[model samples]
Target: MAATVEYDVMMAPEEPERSEEEREREAETCKEKGNVFYAQKDYNEAYNYYTKAIDWSQKNASYYGNRAATLMMLAKYREALEDAQQSVRLDDTFVKGHHREGKCHLLLGNAMAATRCFQKVVELETKNEQARKELKNAAAVLEYERIAEVDFEKRDFRKVVFCMDRALELAPACHRFKILKAECLALLGRYPDAQSVASDILRMDSTNADALYVRGLCLYYEDCIEKAVQFFVQALKMAPDHQKARLACRNAKALKAKKEEGNQAFKDGNFELAHRLYSEALNIDPNNIKTNAKLYCNRGTVNAKLKNVCKAIEDCTNAVKLDETYIKAYLRRAQCYTDTEQYEEAVRDYEKVYQTESTKEHKQLLKNAQLELKKSKRKDYYKILGVDKNASEDEIKKAYRKRALMHHPDRHSGATTEVQKEEEKKFKEVGEAFTILSDPKKKARYDSGQDLDEDGMNMGDFDANNIFKAFFSGPGGFSFEASGPGNFFFQFG
Candidate 1:
């Protein structure tokens, strides 16, 4: 209603260079020409002449009504209503003006207003059966429309339909009533019926934003979110400030676009890009609970892809909190747990997913979790180092030195590519064992159901030269004696 333009006196009259009588004569001439054009079926030209006549003499009630009739022919009901009301305001005795105003009100779906206008027309022209009949019909529609509005405000959409049915019976061709009925049906989850009504309205006026919005809602309810967004966008194009359409369009377009970008990036092995895009989707509608849950689940996948096991578990946990029934959340969280070696937690998650979806893949994942749990429970560091648990510090050191040298990358400098890769893996394993055995605190932690490779100094701790130094050193270690050899020469003393 606020969007309806106020058509106040639209024209400004020129200065009175001529006499008042002469101006009235000029106005009459314009009005005659407007009548000529109206008879010729040139409503646009007729409207221009009427406008000029009104500009010449603002007090001509007939000029206002004539222009209003022309506006009606052009289907500008709101403007016609304004002009007709203006004509009646200027001359209360104008029966044709009242009749035109009532027709405008009827077309605008203001039943009570149409009733009042027709009532006035009947009072001005007794024995007018047309006015009598229209007034009675408008009154019935007004009553039904009142109840429908009250039901709508109460959120009683079924009763809203009940009232609208009677109103439409009295005024079946009213698009406003039909559109209202469609909206009520959509609220009641009758999407197909709502779309049917909207389609009917569109057949009458394809540019009806309300009809477009109803169609969009039907699509949204049917789970065609992307297609629904197009309808919402079209409605918004016509009525930019339609709040519901704007919000729906924004949510659908943003979510779908970001998800598509993320999927493509994930396919192309651009994990960082995928992560960023999914994050943007979450930001678009943070308060959309179900959608946010899905976004969190997808972002968890991205984190898992990027090797962020802890972050992935956290994201999936957040998703589960939003929607506990989300199977993918449990599945993704379990995978992260398995990757991080928290196999018991992984087993619980896989079981959660398997309970709902017991397919071969789910069963295989559960089996994988069970095997990993066993592996995690009994890792043998001493065995990997080729030493007994009771080995002394010196004995452990000698064993580690031998193992590390055998698997070191430099020790296999001329080896094949596959051999070098295998050596690197062995070197990492040996280094992890050495790190655990070398640190008493870490060794105690490992013995107490917790072991971590992150605690180790790893490959950065020693280069080939350092390994050679360790190799050449005595039990008490070696000191360099520069006087025993040439300048800067290494010596074991």
Candidate 2:
């Protein structure tokens, strides 16, 4: 049996088990295949092959290094970083592995880690001037960014701008830094400057939310409210869950819709509805300057129509205060002052309106206010009540009741609808006159010198609005080509 077996295997020694040399050769063969796929830009296939090579020979640092590069192409940065670190650990002299680790750190916003890697790369290979440059850049950018963060938290936008500018100088192509600069500009109310920065960013990445929002603010500051809203809508569309964009869109739409409703209701003589709609618009976004001003002015009109004399005065005053250059607000306030018998104040407001916009209506209002001023200055309350200053209290009371009965709304059923409101106003005036004349102290106070101007009324101030706010492929494991960094840094997987 031995002789037969020897005869069968006589010419061939048993096939020797693969030695370490063969195992390493097989691993290199796999790694070479991975390299070919990588050169072909087939990153997934390259990654698979590289992983296979690692399985075959885990101690081969070149296999792990090559696999890390493949992972970076696939946008698996965190995993890439892990693999790269492992590669460097196994063979501390691997320059490519250190470079990849640095790139991964840079992408993840770990400037300190990135600087350390680059510094080590320079240390390992003294002739690597590119790595040396990267080290300095990372260190400088990290320091400036740290300072910018501190200033930003303090709301010191100027300081933030200063720090961000220094950072941008070091890494001019950083998209995140550009975005931060634009935001700081916006917070400082530098819309035009922010827009310029945002425009540059948009040219690089059109769908960037920070750029879109800053552009919208620019348009809004320019009084292009509708266009601004459209930009915000685009921002929201691009980032569906962006709360800031959502709020901007909602506020803009509500302002537009509510103002339209108020305008229509006012046109239809629905003063109550107009007032409510205007108020709702203001409540929705109290800081929208134009919308806030418009709602105030429009509500003032409604207040006047509904005979809310004091409320009308308050609304119109707020409207004008909010926007000194708003012609309509000044005109509305003038009218309110006239209704409240503040003829001097009315003339002052009308004069401002007349200076900017001269229309037939404004001219008539100016003349009327001037005439009322003359009458108000010499106003006689006892004569207004048809009573002599020396008339007995009984005589004054009887005279007021007679005049009140004649002008009373309830007694004016025969009057046209148009005249009935006027008659009710007259009735109230008659009652007011009666009360003033009947009260000895008030009558004496009025007769002495002053009109009853301060009736324990106070108007609150108007609320103002405060409005305002990557990748490329390249060397190393990461591409810095300025085209677009794929999902590598924030890899989906």
Candidate 3:
């Protein structure tokens, strides 16, 4: 207690509070200093002095107007707009405040609002040439906004870009036109041009959320997904209610997660799960063509693993359609065609692949498809069996049984002679298919494009009727006529 009393005794007297008149004078002096700094292009120092003037005289419209001008010079249009608006609120008849407000509104793409502000400036001072010029620019901006809205809805991106360019010529400082032009350029696949426009805006105003979003879009189109997401996040941070940035960020994150999950599933040999995840990723942003192409190709790989060769081929074809230079899609589709004995189609795809990549692997694939095409001109046992060359023995047997039962001559005895003859021909073909494909040695020779005659087992030597009889025969004498197709059983000994 004694130490506290001794400290209080040594305390100095407080300075007296300044009178309102003194504060007003100090505020005017600070504003004059701000004007000097502003004239010298020292926007930061001008902003600080203007802020000090506003703090000293909170009701002074001129101080706020000066600060608004400094903010505009610093390219902080939104903040400038706030200060400009505050100045107008303090004194509605302040022409300079109204003019600054109009400028901020015009730069921010609020053409209607800017028009009102400039109209007020003209109402207060009829002969303001600068306000008249800004009003004309605002009118041009309105026309551009209208035209751009219509063209953008119709997906006429090129026309939108043209309109934006003209609007920008009238209001060169307008960020809205630049952002719209960049968005249209991205839609038109001019990613570099789009990036250039966005980067220019960012150089002046790094915190412009619309410009950041446009830059993200360009990066996204360029297949820089991670970098695009970063930009989108930054835009969202600057403007929490930015719907485009929010949706894009969500899609980018979901796409990346699904893609990674799909790849993990593929690595784990879970083809079904991988296919589903990849399909989900594709649906996340279907407009992202390059990303969707890779997803389609990945799904095709999963389909191939799942033994869905036709679906795999279809997916790979879609991948190729999305990105014609997708070499993996071409190679995968060619392999699928070759597997399915579509040698002509396989050769075409392989030729396309060879044109892109003249590697030995591609060359060999082309040669193999060409050889298969030549071989395909002859009797195709696998084709007759309705099975692929990679079909297992069990799959071959099942196909043979099904084909034989459907095409057996006895099954069509009630039909006309022409129908009976056709059924008999198909039946014989099925029998011959089973004869070659059911035997591993014969299947190996057939797959190698070798003649069975070289192994002393010519196609002519195999009796289709006898083979059919042996395939369906049971202990005493099984008859296909007595047992309908559905009632047939394997004659297990």
Off by over 4 Å in 1: 1-16, 146-176, 187-216, 225-493
What digit string (tens of lDDT, one per residue) describes model 1 on residues 69-146? Answer: 999999888898899999999999999899989888876778788988898988888988888988887877887888
What TM-score fits each model? 0.41, 0.48, 0.57
What TM-score does candidate 2 get on C-alpha atoms? Answer: 0.48
Give the lDDT ranking, best first.
3, 1, 2
Q: What TM-score does prediction 1 earn?
A: 0.41
- Candidate 2 lDDT, 1-493, residue by residue in tens: 5655444445767777888888888888989999999999999999988998988788988888998998888867788999999999998899999998997777655678989899889889989988887787788778888888898888787888887787766555566777788877766557778989999979867999878987886666444679989899888888888787787777777777888998999999998888888888889865455557777888988888899978888887787676778898888778778767789999998888888888888888888888778756754556666888799988986686567556645456668989987876665566556666777877776665544555441212211000000111222222212224311121111
Q: For candidate 1, give the lDDT.
A: 0.82
The C-alpha local distance difference test score for the whole of candidate 2 amounts to: 0.76
Selected candidate, larger TM-score, 2 vs 3: 3
lDDT of 1 at 351: 90
Clashing pairs in 2: 75-488, 287-465, 471-484, 471-485, 472-479, 473-479, 474-479, 474-480
Candidate closest to the true structure, highest lDDT: 3
Q: What is the TM-score ranking, best to worst? A: 3, 2, 1
Better of 1 and 3 by lDDT: 3
Off by over 4 Å in 3: 1-140, 153-156, 378-493
Please name the candidate that would achieve the greatest TM-score relative to the true structure.
3
**What lDDT tens digits, residue by residue, belong to model 3 across residues 1-493?**
5655444466688988999999999999999999999999999999999999998999999888989999988878899999999999999999999999999988877889999999999999999999999999999889988999999999999999989988877667777788889988987878899999999989888999999998898788667889999999999999999999998888888888899999999999989899999988988887788888999999999999999999999999999998899999999998899889899999999999899889999899899899889878878888888898799988987898789878877667789989988988888888888988888898788888777788887676667767877876756544643466533343334
Of candidates 3 and 2, the better by lDDT: 3
